[model samples]
Every structure is written in C-alpha cells, then in structure tokens.
Target: MRRNTTFLSAAALAVTLALPVQAQDAPDAATVLARVGEAEITLGHALALREQLPEQFLSVPDTTLFPAIVEQLIEQELLHQHKADDLTRRQRSMLDNEVRNFTANAALSEVAIAAASDEAIAAAYEAFAAEFGQGEPETEYNAAHILVQSEAEIEEVAAELDGGRPFDEVARERSIDGSAQSGGDLGWFGEGVMIPAFEAAVMELEPGEVSPPIETQFGWHIVRLIDRRDAQVPPLEEVREDLSGEIQREAARAFVEELRAAAEVENLATDMDPSILGQRELLDD
Candidate 1:
C-alpha cells in the first residue's frame, strides 16, 4: 500500500466501529444524542451508521473523533435543510482543486496496479526461470567451515574421523567455525549459494564423505554434503501479493521518472554550495 504521508499531520483520535446500544431501557438524553434546533437524532442511530466509515477512520481517538464528526453531521443536516440550487464560484474553485488532486493520485495508483496484472507477473517469472536453465535444478549446500592455523590439528581430526568419531563431535572439539556447536550444519540452500571454489568441493562428495583438507579464505575445510535435491518453483499463490506490490511500485517509479523528464523545472540556486540546501529545515507547526 502507498504511504499515507498526507494524513501524518492530521489530528489523532480513537476510532470505534461498533453500534451504540439503544436507550429504551435507559436515560432520555441517550435517545436525543443529536439536537439541531427542533429536530433530534438518537445516539443509537448514529452509532449504527458509524460502521460505514473506513477502517482507519474507525480507529481514531474519541477526543478528536467525536467533535469532528459532530460538526460534520450538523453541517450536513443544515445543508440538507437549505439545499443550494447551484454551487458558488468559491465552492466551484475549491471543488476543482479537490478533483485535480484526487484524479492525479487516482491515475497514478491505477497505473501502478494495472502493471501488476497476471500476464506481467508471469513474464517476470519466466525471465527468472530462464536464467536457471530449462531443467529441474540441483539444490546446493550452504555451510561455513573454520580452519585452525595448524596442519597437525587438521591431521588429528582427520584421524578421529577415520576412527568413526562423530563429525559434529570432532568439529566442536577442533573446528574453529562458530557453527561448531550446531555440528557445522550450514542450513538448507539451493545451488550456487556458496563461492564457486567452496561449492565445487562439496558437490564432489556423497552425503557422508568428508573431504581431505580443502583450502579456502578461512582455511582448510573437512567438507560434508548432508543433503541434495532438485530445485522447484514455489507456488504462485504463496507470492501473488508480493509480486503484485513489487510490480506496482516499479510502475509508479517509472511514471515519476517519465514526468521528471518531461518537466522543465529550474533550480534557481543550482550553482550555490550543496551544504546550504542540506541545512534548511521546515517548521512542523
């Protein structure tokens, strides 16, 4: 969803989306919640109508909510009583401004949403798939190895492994990687998840085979391939909303850039020091 920057400075209020109880068995004042001259409207009736407001409006604080709503209700009632046959010039100007702002925002939003249509999303998916080749892909392993700064230590661990000692036990007692506590299990991942050299060593082995001192940036690795699988595409339903929002944002950004290109905006102080502009701050109130 778009950021609600316009409403950030608006008054705070608690919103309630519930119908009020009738005063049939209670006080008379409750039955006459709204009084405009001789006319009267019940609190219960207004509360019942409150459900029609937007969810955000229903969540405002009562302190700001009640007065604003009361004023609006009174105005609406008065306007109904004395309906204008035609709008005044000022009214037309105000309405024109409102319409212009609304149309601009609406058009931008509609363009963004339309860019996320199923066909567009499907094309994006196809592009990603193409990069991975047209066959079922292999799952790559992701693991970190810690190498001690000694060769003898590597040999001692290799011997323990040859003697059927648990791999995790050897790693905890010897391997310097932070993952030693977790048996050096680097978590599940797809192919190409590791550096090319490191990945090559792991891919060569069977699930239980430990490598013979393969070296990398950190040091030598006693590699183990715990698991492997054919990679698969996730179901579209699981990512539909994510894909839609991403597409919408891209569309909006492109529209903004296009507008910028067409406009002839001038920077009067373009040659002035950049620091001058950076120090200016607007007062909130």
Candidate 2:
C-alpha cells in the first residue's frame, strides 16, 4: 500500500523524539512556541522536530535549531491542515502498516534494553575474555613472499634471492601476485590467516630465512619471515561499548527464539507460489 509520504514524515518527527536527547532541562510540553492560524506549535513540537533532523544538522546549536524547527513545524502544520481530507485509501492502509511496524519496533527495543543489563554485560565480557583474552599472548607474523604460477618460476625466483638480489626488487620485477608491488609484503597477521601449507612453511623459518618452494591453492611461494610478536588484549573499558552491543543482540535473538518455540504459528499461504511476492499489483487490493 502507498503511504502519504508527507504524513509519514510528520509522524517520523514524533518517533525520533521518543529516544533520549542531549542533557538539558526540557521545558513543559504545553509551552506554546508558535501559532499558525488556529494551530499551536509547542516546545514539545519543536523538540520533536529537532530530533528528526539529519545527523549533520544535529551539530547545529540548539539556539539555532529552536527557532528554525518551530518555523518548519509551523509550515508543516499549515500544509497538513489544508490537505488532511485528501488522503487516499492506499495512504490510509500504508499509515496503518507504518503504525504497526513502529509499535512492534518500540516493544522489541524495550525487550533489548531490559536484556542488556549490567550483570548480563559483565557475564558476556567474562565469557569473551575466557575464550580470547587468555593470559597467553596471541602471536602475529610479519612476512613477505614471492608468488609464481609454476615450480620452474618459483625455482628461478629462489635462485635470484639466493644470489643476494634484493627480494623487493625481484618481486617488483617478476612476482605475479598483487603484493608484488609492495615487495610481497603481507604485513602482520595472526594464526589461521594464511593457507595451511604456506603458514606451515612460515612457522618453520626464522627472521631473514627464506622457505624452499611451497605449493598451495594459489600457486608456488618463496616465503620470508620478517618478524613476529605477541598481541595483547585491549582493556575492558576500551571495548565495553562494543561488547554491550553484542550482548544485547544475543539476548534479543534468544528472547525471540523462546517466543517462537512457545507460540503457535502457521503458514496459511503454503500452497501459494512464492513468486507472487514480486507482484506489486497485489498491493492494490
């Protein structure tokens, strides 16, 4: 169903205001800020308009936003009053759908908020730390390679390296892979990052030592171990916000699964062709 975009836009203004705003003692909702004919725009109306503004516009100072939003609301109210009776059947249906969608969203948001409590977050963080933040440091490798399409080409490259020709210079001249431009520098990576055959070769080498020709899915490679180090886990405070978000998502999924399992649901359209979903004409009915 088609909705009146203008009416939805107005309703969105109210929805945005339902979320928390910047810290300030908000004025009473009844405080009238403007009058367009018999219509009254109050402090609450202006606040809702401010909430609906784009992210870039939010950086605009409240002193600037207050008067501007009031003016915009005044214009919107004037237009809405003039056009209210002209709404189509499709517009009404769409409005009903929008209301249902927003109401469900609001309820789900409350469930998510409640699930992501302080205790839940702490437990999630502890589980994460146990799995990945063990006291043993995570190892990372810094390495380079020369890749070629065949054993013959890899052997030729190895000869060049063995003869003391610079790896970067030879890579720039002959290596077929994209990293050839960067002297085959793969930079730093952790375990499980590289192909098993290539990683095995790398693990066996010391700094400045090169691997004999190794074959993998990609091709043949002569690898050099540049350096290696252990990576430390970041402090809890540094990742708390991200961790909290993950906890909330997991909690919401579990809640939904529980509801689904406990509830009776049926697919009434079992015999209908799925392709019918693409028929926009169905919306007309």
What are the per-residue Cα lDDT tens digits for candidate 1 across 1-285? Answer: 222222322322233332343446664535655666776666554554454456787776665665545544555566655754466665555567777777788888989878988899888667755765676666756453545557777777778889998887777777788888887778766766776777888788777677787667777677777766666665677567777788898999999889889999787997888787464342111
TM-score of predicted model 1?
0.44
Best-matching candidate per lDDT: 2
Quality of model 1 by C-alpha lDDT: 0.66
TM-score, every prediction = 0.44, 0.59
Candidate 2 structure quality by residue, lDDT tens digits, 1-285: 222223223433333222223345665877777677888778787666566666776775665555556656766888888877776666666767888877767767888889778888788778877778666778888999999999999899999998999988998888888989999899888889998998999899888888899999999999989998886555678778888788778877887788889999887999999999788665563
For model 2 the TM-score comes to 0.59
In model 2, residue pairs whose N, Cα or C atoms come closer than 3 Å (at least 3 residues apart or on different chains), thus clashing, are: none
Candidate 1 collision pairs: 13-60, 13-61, 14-60, 14-61, 14-62, 15-58, 15-59, 15-60, 140-190, 140-191
